[model samples]
Target: MKIIPLGIWGGYPKANSATSSFLIEDKGFHLLLDCGSGVLSSLQNYISIDELDAVILTHFHHDHVADIGPLQYSKLIQSQLNNDVKTLPIYAPNHEKDFFQKLTFNKHTKGKVLEENKEYAIGPFVIHTIKTTHPAYCLAIKLTVEGQSVVFTADTEWFVELGSFSSMVDLLISESNLYKSFEGQIPGHMSGRQAGLLAKEAKVKKLILTHLPHFGELNQLVAEAKQNYKGEVEIAKVGKSYFLSN
Candidate 1:
């Protein structure tokens, strides 16, 4: 399995970067994890709109799903040009019915409700969803392909149950939106130290910190994470790809 970080910024995009988005591909199947602000432009740098197989959203937050409208319009244009377009299946939580309806407003996109703790097959990937603790209803996703697993802790505060939900994964792509200095200041996002603790508890082979806030010094975040986690750690970069093999 191959995973690429399309955009790593959190909340809003920076001048040159975008908000949370990742592209996971396995066996010629392309699945987008999220489509945040400016993600469509960044995604176009790697793959055409028609190349995408499906999209899975963790929540309805604008920082996570802001580009759905643009992506749907892009797909609609592609369909008009090729006349062989298929509706892209977007798996999302069912709690926010109004938001889900707005996302699927375009004819070229279809929204499917994701059940808590339920596993679903999407091409070569088996997806498992875990309800996460956030202001709005959210989910943390696990993708397994050929026995290799990759877990994404979409956006959540520090929670004890996350360790079990992400146990023994190959990679843990966590959202580290705050530094250790601002742990309790924020209520719905994890700090860099918390991310490291979760990775250590889960015993993941690799940990990549993403959904980064734009204010703090990134090296400080890395150093803080290293203080808690002793394994390989990397700060997510846009357009960079990580591969996992079983």
Candidate 2:
């Protein structure tokens, strides 16, 4: 399996960059993890809109799903051109009904509810979700394919159950959205050191710090995470791919 960062910044995008979005691919099936700001434009740099098979949203936050509208429109245009009108399946939580309803854009995209603790098979992946600690209701995702497993913390603070839930995964994509000094000031986001602590607690083979803060020397986050984690720790870069093996 290969996971690519389409946009790594948090809250809002930096100049010429984007907010939280990742693309996961395995066995020719492409799954977009989020559809945040600039994602639709950044995505074309890697693959065309039609190549995307599905999308799974963590929450209704603008930084996480802003491009969802554009994505639906892209499909609408593509269908008009080719006459191949297959509604792309978007799996998401229904915590906010208004946002959830907008996911269905007639012939372009359709929304599928992702229930807590329920397993959904999408192509070669088995998807699982755990509720996350965020302002808006969010679900942390775990995807397993052919014995290769990876967990994404989405947007969350340090939680005991989350550590247990991600135990022994091959890769942990964590939201390292704050510095150690400002850890608790942000009510729902984790600090660099907190991300490492979770990686150590979960015993993950590798860690990727994502949903990054826009300032304060990005390398500090990697260094802090490495202090607690023995595994490889990297700051997610847009357009970079992290490959996973079984």
Candidate 3:
């Protein structure tokens, strides 16, 4: 299984990175995590957006679901021109049920939307959705492929029980948006130190910090996380793909 970071910016506007989005692929099948504003452009660098099997949106925020409409349109056009039966499966929290239904083309069309705490399977992966603390309806996902597992914590704060969701995963793709100075006050997003603490508690093999803030010293943030966690940690880089085998 491979996880590709489409964009890693915490909130857009800065040029360092885009918003939150990722592509999780195994063999020829592809599953996109969050299709944010910058996702469509970034996706062209890898595979055609129309070829994706499904999209799993963690929340309904702009930085997360902004590209869904465009991607859906592109796929619709492709399906018509190429005589393709390709359909897009969207899984999101209950809060987005009505929103996605309204945004979807064709009133009679059906889109697969799931509430948090539900479990589903896509291709070779078994996915479990967990609720997370965020302003909008948010979720963290755990995906198990083959014998390895990876947990993606999308825009969450330091919660004591978060480790339970990521327990013994091969890779924990957690956010490290703010520095220690803005710890508890930041509300929804977690600091680098907080993510490290969660990873340590979960005993994950590797911690991939992502969704970096627009401004501030990135080196300092990584150093802070290292102080709390003694495991392998790598900041997620956009346009880069990580192949995982355990």
Candidate lDDT values, in order? 0.90, 0.92, 0.82
User: Residue-wise lDDT of candidate 2 within 87-148, one digit each (tens)?
Assistant: 79999999899889989989789999997777889989999999999998999999999889
Candidate 3 lDDT by residue in tens digits, 1-246: 999998888767256455878889987889988888878888888888667887888888788878778877787777778866655677777675577674456521236766677788887889988888888878899999888999999988877768898998999999888999998787899988888888889999989888888788887777888888899887888888788886
lDDT of 1 by residue, 71-96 (tens): 88888888788994588999999898
**Model 3, residue 79: C-alpha shift (Å):** 2.9
Error of 3 at 214 (Å): 0.5
Please identify which of the two predictions, 1 or 3, would achieve the higher lDDT against the true structure. 1
Candidate 2 regions exceeding 4 Å error are none
Candidate 1, residue 98: Cα displacement in angstroms equals 0.8
TM-score of model 2 (CA atoms): 0.98
